[model samples]
Target: MWRELAAIGRETSTGGYRRYAWTAADTDCRSWFRDQAGARGLSHETDRNGNQWAWLGDPAAGDAVVTGSHLDSVPDGGAFDGPLGVVSAFAALDELRSRGAEFTRPLGIVNFGDEEGARFGLACVGSRLTSGQLTREKAYALTDADGITLPGAMEAAGHDPGAIGPDPGRLARIGAFVELHVEQGRALDLSGDRVGIASAIWPHGRWRFDFRGEANHAGTTRLADRRDPMPAYAETVLAARRAAELAGAVATFGKIAVEPNGVNAIPSLVRAWLDSRAADRATLDTVVAEIERAARDRARSDGVDLSVVRESFTPVVEFGHALRDELNRLLGGRVPVLATGAGHDAGILSAAVPTAMLFVRNPTGVSHSPAEFAAEDDCAAGVLALADVLEGLACR
Candidate 1:
């Protein structure tokens, strides 16, 4: 599965992947999924929100114990973030099936679509839509960087846009969900373990700050007369860092756009996004409010117009307690339980169904970049652990 997926997507010059959802690369990945499932005689179907599911037994026989993850990638994202969970899921199922393990209940794997939202700017779009967290209208109206609507993209890709919406009936088939993912940080590395269990996800969100100023030529504009928004944008970045540091949180101004981007022009507008996470809702709200206030103050001082809009917010998610306890006892590793600042489809699905996650140790503790890595031994161990968990859940 690894080799097959690696061959379809664009590996950037920097060594990361560019497998945006609904694109040709993602289409090829889906085809690969269908072929793999077909070869195993597993029934495969796509949900209303584009999530793909492959069932080992009858899907309608009973609520299935589902395991899997997203196949899409952030632009230039690490190879393992989404695909590792998916590949591990397939491997675990293969192990169980080969061993003559019988699952009385349905056992299934899923490949959720648009989890990264690299093109549409809405992370976990597939999961969110499936769980009714995002409305169909909002999802269909989402636009890419080039102003292409999501519906337009779906139509062009041969999918009916009208079919996109919340799917309670489809979601009802998931009795439980377990996702085995590559750890995005050094939690497991610090503990010297091959795998860990996720306890919760920190409250996190994305906010856009737009700053506007007068446009003038670099050669003609005097420093005293110019009201460039760049300085305010810089101040906003600094404010984010300060807020996060002071509040014991995390914030990043990762995406930015400067309008009239001519090297010689002191331009009109600066749009920057703040990705922030905190341990609690109150703390996160406070940190964001402070950052916004700071940005506003700096904008006023620079005579720049500023507006802040929240694009999305995922509140703190606690994994289903019973599921976590069962896995802890069933796997019997005394695996470390961790809280992640990063979001996942598992986290999104936790809203509707019981969801748990197993994270394979990432040696580099870096993600969303090319440097993120997990040793083969650790990956193999993760597959074994996931197989154990899935077998227990599906057979019990």
Candidate 2:
């Protein structure tokens, strides 16, 4: 399964995946998913919001046990971040079939679209749309860097733009949803465990900071006479690091753009996106507030106009205790429970469904990069663990 998916959307220069939403790369991934479902002889369908589902039994049968994750990737993302869960899902089903598990309920595997939000800047778009956390109007308003709207991209990719909206009936049929993923951090590695359960997702958000100033020739403009926004933007980046450290949170200026992006020209506008997260809502709020305040102070001193817009925000998500406890029992109660700073489709769906997650150990504790990895043994363990959970949840 990994071999088949490894080549799709991979950038030769970076050895990282670029499976962004509604692009050719993503289309290839969707095709791969369909092929996988067909190979397994599962009834397959694409939901209104573009999420794919493969069912082993009638989906109309309520209380279906569903497991899987997205197949999309961030810019130059690691192979395991999203695909691990999906591959593990199929592998788990094979394991269950080998064990001759008698199903008492329907089983499903899903590939939720646009979980990375690399192009549209909104994570978990498919799941969010299905859960009604994102309105069709707002989703239609989402535009990519190339000035293409989300609906336009969907249409170009041969998906219907008008069919997207909340699908409560589909969600209501799901009794439980479990997503297995590669550990984004070293929690399982540090604990000497191959698999762990997710406790909660930290409150996280993305904010856009724009600093406006006069553009001029970099070589000719005097340092004292020129009003450059780059310096202010740089200071804000440092300020964010300091604030996050002080508040025991995490913040990063991961993406940015500059008007007149040239080595010989001073930027007229420096726009950067801040991704911030904390264990709790109060700490997250405080960290972001301090960072914004520092940016404002620096912008005033640098004579640059500053504006901040919160592009997206997700509150902390605590997995339901009943489902989590059931998974613990299914896994022999030895797996460690850990919290994460990362957001996910499971986190988005937890609002409307009983959702949980499993994390495979990552030795390097790296993610969203080519260097991110998991051992073969750890992946095998993850697949077996998922198989056990599914057997307990859906089998007699």
Candidate 3:
């Protein structure tokens, strides 16, 4: 499975995946998912929100046990972040069948769309839409860097934008949803464990800062006489680092755009996006406020007009105790439980459904980059653990 998926959306230079939403690479990944479902003899279907589902039993049957994850990637992302869960899902099903497990309830595997939000800037769009966290009107207004609206992209990718909205009926049918993913951090590795359960997701958000200033010739403009947004933007980046250090949080300005980008010209605008996260809501809020205040102060001193807009936010998600306890029992009460700063589709669906996540050990704790990886034995352990959970949940 990995061999076939490794080639799709991969960049030759970086050896990373670029499977952005609704793009050709994303299309290829979707096709690969459909083919996998067919090979498994599972009933394949696409939900109104473009989430792919493969069912071993009747979907209309209530109290279905579903397990799977997304197949998209961040910009130049590593191989295991999303695809590991999906491949593990299929492998788990195979393991269950080999064990002669008999399902008393319906079983399902899903491949959620636009999970990374590399194109639309909103993570978990597929699950959020189905759970009614994101409104259709707002989703329609999402535009990419190329000035293409989300609706246009959906239409071009052969999905109906008008059909997208809250999918209460579908979500209501699911009794439990479990997503198995490669760990984004080193919790499992540090503990000498191959698999662990997620307890909570940190409060996280993305904010955009727009700094407007005058455009001039870089060589001719005197430093003391000019209003440059770059200086303020640079200072804000440093401030983010300092504030995060003080607050015990994490913040990064990973993406940016400059107006009239040229080496010989002073940029008129500096648009940067900040991604910040903390273990709790209050800490995250305080950290972001401090960063914004620093940016404003620097902008004023530099004579630059500044505006900040929050693009997306997800509050801390505490997985339900009942299901988590059940999983612990199913896994023999030995697996470690850890909290994560990263967000997942499981986090988005936990509000509407009984959702939980399992993390596979990552040796280096690196993610969202080409260097992200998991040991082969650890991956095998993950598949076996998922198979055991599904058997415990559905077979009995």
TM-score per prediction, in order, is 0.98, 0.99, 0.99
lDDT of 1 by residue, 60-172 (tens): 87678999998889878888998898889899989988878889889888999999989999999989988999998798779999899988887787787787878888778
> CA lDDT of 97 in candidate 3?
91
lDDT of 3 by residue, 301-366 (tens): 989999999999999999999999888899999999999999999999999999999999999999
Q: How are the candidates ranked when ordered by lDDT, highest leading?
A: 2, 3, 1
Across residues 1-396, which tens digit of lDDT does each residue of candidate 2 receive? 999999999999999989999999999999999999999999999999999999999989899999999999999999999999999999999999999999999999999999999999999999999999999999999999999999999999999989899999999999999999999999888889999999999999999999999999999999998789998899989999999999999999999999999999999999999999999999999999999999999889989999999989999999999999999999999889999999999999999999999999999899999898999999999999999999999996
For each candidate in the order shown, give its overall lDDT on alpha carbons: 0.90, 0.95, 0.95
Residue pairs with clashing backbones, model 1: none
Q: Determine which window of 10 residues in candidate 2 has minimal summed lDDT.
A: 224-233
| Ten contiguous residues with the weakest lDDT in model 3 | 142-151
lDDT for model 1, on a 0 to 1 scale?
0.90
Q: What is the lDDT of residue 33 in candidate 2?
A: 93
Query: What is candidate 2's CA lDDT for residue 178?
Result: 99
